[model samples]
Target: MTWTFEEMDRMFHPRVVAVVGDKKDRDYMWLRSVSTLKGKVYSVQVNPEEAANIVAMGFPNYSSLLDIPEPVDYVIVAVPRHVAPRVLEDAIRKGVNGVMFFTAGFAETGEPEGIRLQQVLTDMARKARMKIVGPNCMGLFNPRWGLRHSPEQYYDDGGPVGFISQSGTHATFFSLVGYQHGVKISKSASMGNGIILHADDYLDYLGQDPQTQVIAMYLEGVPNARRLFHLMQEIGQRKPIVVWKGGQTSEGARAVQSHTASLAASTALWQAAVRQANALWADSFDETLDLVKALCFLKEPVGPRLGLVAMTGGQSVVITDAFAKAGLQVPLLTPRSYQELATFYSTIGGSYRNPMDMTPTSRNLDMVRRVLDILARDDNIDAICYEFNMGFSAREGMVERLVDLLGEFREAYPRPFLCVLSAVHREAEAVGVRQALAQRGVPAYPSFQRAGNAFRKVWDYYRERRERGATRPAPAPAGPVRPG
Candidate 1:
């Protein structure tokens, strides 16, 4: 059953959503998850006890989807496997836009009954041309519309990333953890089993979504490799798509079969195909979010040459090595840059070479600004990375000033400016500082490795973009900007 983009759009942004089979025994989990939805919500339960409890929780209860007074745009099915077909039938009869089968005893279980039940549901939905998200998955999350699969997801705020994951756990946690690091979601889906709607379906939908600037995927496998790769090649030319393939190893491949009933492809082939399609590849959850964050905040394709700044001498060496290991260059500054630095640089406790180390003089905002200014003007420097101790910055009452300075440089200079906050014992302080910088449209990371690696991915993405002749500067960082 091929669904049109407009039909899928309605499913994502529903005006009225219904939760089927939410019972008191499970604490009405599905009901609670969607209770915060901005649109009207109703509960469909045959059990009188559960229906009464749902009503007590302040939601209308219906014995069947047909019993609902108004048209239902979306339905969340949480009934047992045997009852899933009945719910889908009712949903099709009601002519709803879509249904998410939260019930999990589908083909992934590898049981004869599970397989048969899944086929039955699939056939019925396909025959009716009704879109089903998953037979063994968590559903969708649209923060802008207050639609969510977990109660913990943030609403009333949205960003440029649209994430698609085969694992419900990854989908839920990605949004939760991403919020901590300033990577918010415009929409996300956890499509387990994907019996009716496949990963490529969601990818194509997100590609056309104007709200999403960067699309990230956590996939074990896709049903149609050719279609997926073809779509990636086309969509990636416009918006960046970062893919993190799961089940890469032999053991993981076997696990993927039971997890989502997906047929894992060869790792080598997957990686090569991803690059050929002009999409970025990530190894882990952290790398995916880091790449997304970098893509979200950095606006242009940067050169591999980076100008490094560190609070201490030792850090300068460590930062350089980290970036160098990540395939980035930390070459010496141009002759004119070094000459300009020598005029005011204090050689007493610092060296003004590539990674300028301000031993005890970093506290002077004027000198710090001057050094950054010189790097910004240096033709050889394509980007700048500054490292500081978050604990000291907060204690010295310099967090706001430093953020303002970086923000100013970010705006005044076209080169990418990044910040690395040393949060060894100061993780709590780093969080606040990161948020402050993010509010000002500056990206900050907790470690040199992550800062370097993420920036490299961003650089690679834009460099490829430029190589393909799509040379327009990336759209201004897609999230909120601090008010002047």
Candidate 2:
């Protein structure tokens, strides 16, 4: 339908939303999902029982989209597949800006009827110049406006990340899991069986979205590979785009067709395309969030040289190996940095080389602060990683103090500083500490491997950005991206 950016924006930030066929049978799922939306919500149900129930829920009930008094900005169609055409006709007649077809049984079903129905709706929407999100997908999630695809999704705590996924489950999971890990989203779309609107359309819109600073994508496949790749190259130059392509394997590709009717590309071809476009690639959900967290929280790391701080000698060796294996350098600190460390750096059960083993001395906050200061000033190091066992830190009553110290270092230093909080039989305590660190603008991972991997992705992104002369000014230091 060739929707304008403004039109898409309004659809995302709708003033009025309508849900069709939200009945007690499904527990009024679609209606409840949009309950937190900061706009008028109407239920379109022809059934008298469902209408009365929707009224009891407080949202006004209407027989059809045309019966609604207000102009519907967005419509969620949850009617049966056979009834979808009628709803779409009504929606088009009502002049709705967008309709997200949450109803399944479309082309993904692989039946002729299903495919024909999909084409029918596609033609209708295009003829009427209507914007449709998905006939088999989860639609838009705008946290800022509390427009959500699921009731469980967070609201009113928007961040700088914009996510696009083909699978509805992946979209919902990304928002749910990403939020707990400090990767709150600005806007996200689950574009299932993207018939009328392609993934490139969402990418183009998000690329220009002022609220979005980093874009994350979960793609089963792209219908127009060339256009998608071009958008990646153009948009990625401005904002980092992290892509996690599903259907990389033969089995996954077979599943992708049935799941979204998508044509999965060869893994080699997809990887090469992503690298050529200078877009980051992630292998799984965790990696996607990890990369996003790093991109959102960390400053632009100028080099691969990483300075490591571990509480124990074994940890130092392990983390060093982790980072090095992740394609990051654990080079020796400059002579000047070593000379400064020699001043009060005791050699008792600790070493102050690259991965400064702060075993016994780590208990002393002053010594930890000094070590961080030394690393921050060292030219050989572009990023810093500090590892601590959360269980021990809490027992020593140093969690709060360490978080504050790290917060200070984060603010004072331009280098990207991260913390790896090992659970060590205290997983709950580790989560609290990680949250605290996140609140103070420090990216904390559960393990050394995660910390190193996330940092390496950020490093690769910045390095590519620099090489392309597309580097933007460093983001201002801030707490977690979530709004207070």
TM-score of each: 0.96, 0.95
Q: Which candidate is the best by lDDT?
A: 2
Can you list the residue pairs that collide in candidate 1? none
Task: Please give the lDDT score at residue 51 for candidate 2.
Answer: 91
Error of 2 at 65 (Å): 1.5
RMSD per prediction, one decimal? Answer: 2.3, 2.0
For residues 1-484, write the lDDT of model 1, one tens digit per residue. Answer: 5567898899889999999998877778888888777799999988888778889999999899999999999999998889988899899989898999989988999999999999998898888888889978889998888888887777877878899999999999998877776777888999999988898899889888888888999999888888889989888887888999999999999999999989999999999999998889999998998888888777585689999999888898999999999999998889999899888898887888989898767888888899999999998899998886665565466878988888888889887888888878877667667777776667888789999999998898788878887635245353542210
Off by over 4 Å in 2: 395-397, 473-484
After superposition, candidate 1 runs with Cα above 4 Å error: 471-473, 476-484
Error of model 1, residue 125, in angstroms? 0.7
Judge candidate 1 at residue 319 and give its lDDT: 95
For candidate 2, write residues 1-484 as lDDT tens digits.
3557898899899999999998897888888889988999999989998899999999999888998998999999998898999999998998999999999998999999999999999999989988989989999999889899888887876878899999999999988877666667889999899988889999989988988888999999887889999999998888888999999999999999999999998999999999988889999998998888888778778889999999889999999999998999998999999999898998899999889999878888899999999999998888899986665575466888988999889989997888888877887666567767777778888778888888888788778778888857336234444422
